[model samples]
Target: MKTSLAVASATVALAVLFPFAAAEAQQAKPQSWPGIKRTDLQRHDLSAPGREVIQVHVDFAPGAAVPAHSHPGEEIVYAIEGAMEYQVEGQSPVTLKSGDVLFIPAGAIHSVKNAGSGNAAELATYIVEKGKPLLVGK
Candidate 1:
């Protein structure tokens, strides 16, 4: 009877601790977005579900242009090198030089075109909302 009681107590303790062990197992380790390169444009997913963020780098060749697209979250661009033209929905295209920043509202259609005859590069950070599309149109 004493051995039976001991076995029951150990079983109860294990059941209580099982959930914590499972939770610890469920925790995700830190990871970097693969395929990030400095010489070329790249898109990287930073987090999951409750923390979704996409990082896009634009390395434009001479006179390169990105077609109009809509973002699910508010998107912003920081021009790192060269000049480019920005066009947003209901707004005229504006010339943006290096070191300039632009704010794009959520669901706004926009495009980026390199203005200069040389290469233009930009580092962009996007705050993506859950279930929101990153690109609206082709």
Candidate 2:
């Protein structure tokens, strides 16, 4: 009877703690958006103090959009396929085609949309502060 009670107590404890654990796990990773796929290509520590570089390949389904967000540092985006429109805060939206590049200043609020009828993709390179969330939604 004592062994069963102990097991029941442990189970209750786990049940109580599980949600907090899950929430922490979600915060540890970057936020995700529907219809957007992000693949981490590489990550390396930069020479600058407390800085790191992260390269990601992002694919957007037709007419998909990412909500306004900002990074801790600068982002260099290279459009790889199809067309994408980028809207940077306080600036006119710009569309980029294949092989085009755009530089986004650090902490600049921005959003992206797949402007073409087909899927669009871009390679994003970020120079950001280490140990901080790569993307912060505005």
Candidate 3:
């Protein structure tokens, strides 16, 4: 298990447990969702425009990374090749290999490092709240 947070609403039963729990669950699901290639993601159903959602295919050359950044929305990264070390603000990093997943909550400061010896890649599906931008450069 990993540290997480969730948005909650009174109408949502799970929200009753803890407001943050609901947000965590909602944001966390994307990290574990099935993934496809960048081309495939282009053909998949995407959230409405202006709603702030994006599917990104991140390819790395041995040790490349997307760089450190923060976002207004929750993000999920699914490893498509090799392995990756993921770290969030104030937490120990975790490593994941092909088919592995990582969940990052909204506004969580995080970074990704490619740990594989060869070429590596990851598919990131970013889910953000309405009207929020998907990715912010560090």
TM-score of each: 0.61, 0.78, 0.60
Candidate 1 residue 20 Cα shift, in angstroms, is: 30
lDDT of 2 by residue, 1-138 (tens): 999999999899779866754563366343456678776667789989999998989999997888898999999999999999999999999999999999999999999999999999999999999878787878
Any idea what lDDT model 3 has?
0.64
Tens digits of per-residue lDDT for model 3, 1-138: 122323333236444545543354344343332331222142233456644556768766676665566886778888888888888888998988999998898889887777878777888877766544444545
Which 10-residue window of candidate 2 scores lowest in summed lDDT? 21-30
RMSD of each: 15.0, 9.4, 14.5
Q: Rank the candidates by TM-score, best first.
A: 2, 1, 3
Off by over 4 Å in 3: 1-50, 130-132
| Candidate 2 residue pairs that clash | none
TM-score of 3: 0.60
Using lDDT as the measure, which candidate wins? 2
Residue 127 in model 2: shift from native, Å?
Answer: 0.2
Worst 10-residue lDDT window, candidate 1: 28-37
Q: What does candidate 1's lDDT look like per residue over 1-138, in tens digits?
A: 999999999899779866744442233110121221232133345556543565667677776676677777777788888888999979988888888999898788897778888888788777777544455663
lDDT of 3 at 128: 68
